[model samples]
Target chain A: MLKLLTFVKNCKEGVLRATPKKPRETRRKKILQTALEILPQRGFDGITLESIADALGYTKPAIYYYFKNKDDLVCSLVTDYLKDAHQAICAITDGNGSPKERLIRIIHFYVDRNCEQRGYFTIDHHLGGVLRKMPHTAEADNLRKLSLEIPSRLIKLINEGIQLGEFRDEDPAVLGSLIFSLLGGVLTHMEMPSLASLGVEGLKQRVCDFALKGIVV
Target chain B: MLKLLTFVKNCKEGVLRATPKKPRETRRKKILQTALEILPQRGFDGITLESIADALGYTKPAIYYYFKNKDDLVCSLVTDYLKDAHQAICAITDGNGSPKERLIRIIHFYVDRNCEQRGYFTIDHHLGGVLRKMPHTAEADNLRKLSLEIPSRLIKLINEGIQLGEFRDEDPAVLGSLIFSLLGGVLTHMEMPSLASLGVEGLKQRVCDFALKGIVV
Candidate 1:
């Protein structure tokens, strides 16, 4: 009984630590990475803290030490995913080349990430409906904001492209929406037998070719 | 007791008619139409036979007479909606004018349908996820086939456009997927405040303009 009490105390203290200790943070990252690896194979409903723990060869309590529950883990995973994607996109937008060049890079960035993280995109698409049904949480709000911000950044870049005569003079908002739509559709249908035969490089080339031609002067 | 037996007899007879009697068929159509009218406003969860009946000044039994239950009603509604859309698209595809003109008509058809029947599209979007989760039914099978057929038709038109040099040389399948993605994305985001301001015609023009520019030779 005393040993059990000590273990419980230790887990609670680990969760409440002001800053996650280094080893604990590493384990947490591993847990999230493993969760993503398993997601596409098993789907959202099939994943659980216990399953993730089992995959990592850790105990369930070890998983819970970092995340309060499954929702906490999933929420953090999505938040981090979006944060990383947003930062990458922003960097491209803020970097060298002209608006058109940056736009092409952004398209490539999206396609590459999507092809590499097929599981994440599948989960993200499913989450679109699920998140709307969920009550507003700080996590959900942050996610919504990040999702909107990424596209808005692209829209701003398109505006710059138009001003510089790199892209046709058109409503940037409309163009951005259409481009994103094309990306979303392609990503959603990537697994279709017909498209799958094109392989990654072929798919990337087609998307970039279609999207760039749609806007470029 | 005799009157109750007669009422049951009449209802069962109404359902069993070999070719639906005019009155019964008209009433069944009314039930389906009213369900659609209520679907967007109330959503799938909020809608029920009772609500649809109340809207149409009929009893729940009047609904059950045509549909076995809520699922039957929804399945029929989806089947009818897709059938109608598929037939209309075929008509346009088979009609006069260049491939470009027909493609534009198809886009217009989609935009116009989506705008006018906002409820249907909303329900359809929600149903995309729902249908996947559902066990396969004949209705589900039909709906799936029709959905694929519509896109296949578009792909064929794109191929014709390329052959005629009306469109640039590219994979018709890839282009078709991209175009559908654009249309799907636009329809999905139609309610966003940013795009809503564009109004229906403005939105239609943008879709056609961007899509045509992408492939036009």
Candidate 2:
């Protein structure tokens, strides 16, 4: 009975510790959310650990425990995004479909993701300026590679489409860049009330249709 | 004989003053050119009076004599471009031609100008980030108005096209934005060697074709 009681007490303690750990995870998520909110307005240099902590009703030490500093925090935020984007791109590109279908799906995925993460992109636009200044840093270099990969993946898709004779015989590299540019231009306009009025699906369809007509066989 | 000598001396003085003024004008142009060269690489904050002076082999006070300050220099550069853009837009919008033709001409003008001024757009991209931060400043507000006018002019042209039954019955505002987005996307790509390899006329033709197909009935 004594052995059984000791085992039961240990199990209960483990469960109690697990419960508190989840709240810390929740707090970390909340910190990232608050950081995203401030980034679009103030940019990277403008944000500080204290500002994030103050927004979350926590102390600076509390944030430091979660994120080493602003650089680590921003790296976490950006890498997390890039990971998700890479996964989405892979799923769409690797899926079984015609080149046209795959290309359309890729565009849709980008449009949908941007729409879903509307405010996050505003932060990204601000972060771009910060990144350009520190282009030689490892994190900035990684970001550049990731950004270039997006267009490169599209180029592959376009090349596949061309070989399959689904798309017109245009330079895949140029077309990929053009599509990337189109997506970027539309996303920038999304912040405008007039364009946002088109809503998500409506705008996606328009963009896809425009892109399709440009290169469809 | 005294009257003749006085006339000759006055003519000599006038010629000497004119000769110095020509060099002053040339120097002012050189300063603007050097500033444009540095802007794309360094952004607005990264640039300083000392840096511009260093690039041009002049003293800061010399630069100050040409431009009151950094803000004055940038304002002058941007306003000069805007002034030229405004005049070109007005000529295209008000000139006699089919709405479709006028629109294509405008797109070509923009593409050509951007291709011709490739490095300049890089500076513009950086300036955009700076403007976003101080969006309510007088210069920023003026830039906002000028930017809006570009799209607004397109909307008018599209409206006329729809009335003439040249374009499909779509929202003129939406179509204008779409064209604007397409133009923006293509202009950005003009700087990349891969895209610039498409050459000015080739890239302009592709942009025109894509835009025309999107709206043509």
Which one wins on TM-score? 2
lDDT for each residue of candidate 2 in B33-142, tens digit (9 for 90 to 100): 88878876666767788998999899999889788888777777776776677789889999999999999999888887766665467654544564555447777798
Name the top DockQ candidate.
Answer: 1
* Candidate 1, TM-score of its B chain: 0.81
Interface RMSD after interface superposition, each candidate: 1.4, 1.3
State the lDDT of candidate 1 residue by residue for B1-217, as single tens digits.
9988977887787644644488777888888888888887777767899999999999888788888988888777777877888899999988999999999999999899888877678665665655665568776876777777887888889899999999989878877877877787788777766678899999898889888887899
Each model's DockQ?
A: 0.52, 0.48
Worst 10 residues of 1 chain A by lDDT: A126-135
Segments of candidate 2 deviating more than 4 angstroms: A1-21, A122-148, B1-23, B122-147
Q: Please list the C-alpha lDDT of all candidates, in the order they appear.
A: 0.81, 0.78
- Model 1, stretches more than 4 Å misplaced? A1-23, A34-64, A123-145, B1-27, B34-65, B69-71, B122-145
Q: Give me candidate 2's TM-score against the actual structure.
A: 0.80
Each candidate structure's TM-score, on Cα atoms with residue i matched to residue i, is 0.79, 0.80
